[model samples]
Target: MSNETPLPLVMLRAVVSGGCDVTPPQRPLTPSGRN
Candidate 1:
């Protein structure tokens, strides 16, 4: 939650505009698995 403090609104706007079909990873869970 700490990381989301700044861009929280951006995220909310994205989901609100993009709809529930979109999916985003939490953290340390890179899609490339490099972390």
Candidate 2:
């Protein structure tokens, strides 16, 4: 593998580690910010 982290993977990791304990359902990034 190239060793470079994928964008989605990085985002998912951020979301998962960021606030899954506080708010699991609304964890994913908003479309306005994602784009």
Instruction: Compare the candidates by TM-score and give the number of the best one.
Output: 2
**For every model shown, what is its TM-score relative to the native structure?**
0.38, 0.46
Cα lDDT tens digits, model 2, 1-35, are: 45898989889989878766546345555443534
As for candidate 1, its clashing pairs are: none
Question: Where is model 1 more than 4 Å wrong at Cα?
Answer: 1-5, 20-35
Per-model CA lDDT versus the true structure? 0.59, 0.67
Error of 1 at 26 (Å): 24
Look at candidate 1 and tell me the lDDT of residue 30. 43
Q: Poorest 10 consecutive residues of model 2 by lDDT?
A: 24-33
Best candidate (score: lDDT):
2
